[model samples]
Target: MVSGSNGDGVRVPSASFSRLSATNVLFGWTWPQLAVGGVGLVLLVIGGAAGFNLPVMLVGVLVMAYGLVRFQGLSLLAWTYVWFTWRSRLREGSNVWSSSPLETGRTVGVLGVWSQVEDRAQVVEGESVDVVGTPWRDACYLYDPDKRQATAVLTLKVEEWSLSTNARKRDRAMALNNLTMTLASTPGVVELKETSLLMPTSAPVPPDLDDPDMPSWARGDLAELWAMPEIATPLANVSWVSVSVNVDRLSTRSRNMDRLTERNRVGVLLGDIVQNVVAPALVECGGQHGSIRWCSVDELRDMIRCVSDPAHASSQRKVRRGEPTLSYCEESADGEYVTLESCVARSWWVTQWPDRPVPAGWTRDILQGDRMIALTHIWRPLSMAESEKDLANKQSSMLQRSRLADQKRLSRDERRERREQAQREAEQDANWPDTDHQGYITLFAPDKSRLDDLERGLRMETGKYHLTLNGLTGQQRKALATVLPLGV
Candidate 1:
């Protein structure tokens, strides 16, 4: 819950997210569970017809139990399937990737990632306004060939909470709420990803002290002093929001056009959404004009590189066109962490957020510091119809579950609290559309030896904020992809 006000002002905003309902496909059972249970039932029927064979009936009961039993939130059967899938991927060497320059016609620079970057400028927009005269010239879109989706990035300049007054913080919080609503209502927008990274600054090279006018002894002493390690300081804060447009959703009306034309049309629609829809919402958050703008091609590439390889983020090397944002030459996923050419990384999913209300910008503590950590939050917005249907189903399910609990004579206090929280959620949904959100945080290290220490520190840091991080032990590769800001 969050609220802010100053003397006679309206309450800013407050939200309750105490519980999340897991809606299943049929009668609170997933498809896999239903299928398995059906087979078990058939077996029991056969046993009954065969004079109630004790062994057969026992086997059937066990099978049903397997389908119903859950381990770490997954049914026993589903858990077994996942384990086998992970092993298969590992045995097939699919979890390992190594780039070979000698291979002919092989796609480089983050293979199996997004497709080429394409310009969204059109002839009708006027050639003069289409082209940009900056280093990362012209607005471009990252196209995913597999999904046929286009993603556009916007660089955000958020206001500092510490520097703002109480009234300003209240306004900013409301603006953030408005931003969330805008994203949910925007047409053709499938996902919104906000990525923030902090890169550490390295010690500066000693100045050229070999002056002919200076004495030799003094020059030597000065050089020695400059060679000492420099104090650590904050480097840079890179934040960007990527908005992905669903091409298939927008292409329905333009069936007669060719593929290229359809893609261009979708791009034009995305450009308008960014400019007219997202830009204004961002302006409110920043408390200033022009707080958000479309990221240029070069800037996007740099942002990707910074998240990909933090050690070299401050390098003076120019980001070339069509060059891959990730600089690693090899990547191997292990049981606990992933080994890359330049760094070792481990990913964690945020399983819990703060259960109680806290001040705004509470997350600043995690993002700040010299640690090499990146936090990516992905939001999949639901349309009005979808939101209404989902909420209705969830509310009904909650009430039914509550009734069952009452019949079982379960803990009354817990059930009552959950029902009240569900009610608050329903009321909130009535005011705004619903969005599915997930967060992933990845910590990078120079080598495997330092990974454990970093993980310990990260876990402790997150514990302070009541945030829980569950390490993705065997799914390191997938977790890495999920945490990175490549619209994964």
Candidate 2:
């Protein structure tokens, strides 16, 4: 595999097999599975001691094996909890109880007929007079009454580039490295919660029969070519990046403040991050960053409608519809645990990360599939002191594990490897910056059949990078919001 240097000058492999060790086997089993298996094993032992019938002993063994193999008891438990919660909501007969964090926050009711200000220069004046709260250059800002927080969604335009030439490839790689470093260093740049890259399934090109440059003979050929169903036409791809910044967490004030004050403060912070950090970082990376626009109430409603109701998407009727004033979303099904959506969506949690070094663009495959997918990376910043303490505790835990492994006569290689890893982590704690990150990917489809097809494609894509994804069964609604740019 080809190798390249990252911002830290570390040699990164283009692709490689992930590291496999004994610890992986233990980690593969969830706690619930382990507990179930343990109970089954105890039953088997008790049955054997009492000289119980062979059938009873066989049943116990089978239960133990099933628990070890399926590891689905936990998911079932989670679904049960969701079922009870839904029942309670039904009993209460109030919409106040919600599973989604997006709906739990303060209700401003629905503001109608919000409009986007196309001219960047008029943003400030627009906010002061006509706009609802604080007007951002690119994004719309809203105050969440429940959380006392301000949320903004910035739409960034991703510019496409060619990498066919070696020189172009090298330059792009360097640009990506620089962008990565910039993001890592930027303050208040927490997480990229969700990114949506959409490409139309089919595009049709009409023949220009009236063009004077075209010969009469060529016109018939062009018309025939345009009519051919076998030919594929290319369409422009659109991408949106959703990010959430915690206004309450960023504020210095201890007491509750006015909604307008909170809105303005959060708005300024979002603008600075976009302009000073995101925009400059993209420019250095041989790419251009677009204006950071806020999603107007109308825009938000349209988005929800498009995602929830696929008919609107397929018919393309909603494309030209002017943004509506207010929008509300409701899930179509409950308790079955698979189809959870304001429209229809399936959420997946990243169960495993690549264990070995991979190219910087390892995630590119995620966007290549035919289905609409949203990938989210949630980063939680850790203070230097907190990181150091956490590392020290981990080191202590590793040492104890190593000792236990030695006493149990486990593989010497595995024990030695654990010691080495602990040592490396100690060195890293002392030298490298600390950041905790979580990632989620959500797949949206029009129906169950489409969702199933997309899920298979996604699994194949993720497998290529040595990553693992597990469906977030009962937590689909929560996971969906978490993956969206709506700072839940």
Q: Report the C-alpha lDDT of model 1 over 390-413, residue by residue, as the tens digit.
A: 766666666667676666765643
Q: What tens-digit string does per-residue lDDT give for candidate 2 at 1-488? A: 24666565655435322122222123335576677778888888888888885776787887677656633223343455666766665465431222334534433234311111111111221254323333343346554454544445555555454432444445555654444344545555554443554533344556679999999999988888876533343323344454444555653354344555544556666656655665565554445445435465445544544454433433445332333312333333452223323335777767666755576556666765456666776645455565566556555555556666665765654554555455546545555434455677877766777777887788887787668666654456566556645555
RMSD of each: 5.4, 8.4
lDDT of each: 0.64, 0.52
Best by TM-score: 1
Model 2 stretches with alpha carbons more than 4 Å out? 1-135, 144-148, 161-190, 201-205, 208-236, 251-260, 285-295, 309-343, 407-431
Pairs clashing within candidate 1: none
- Against the hidden reference, what TM-scores do the models get? 0.80, 0.63
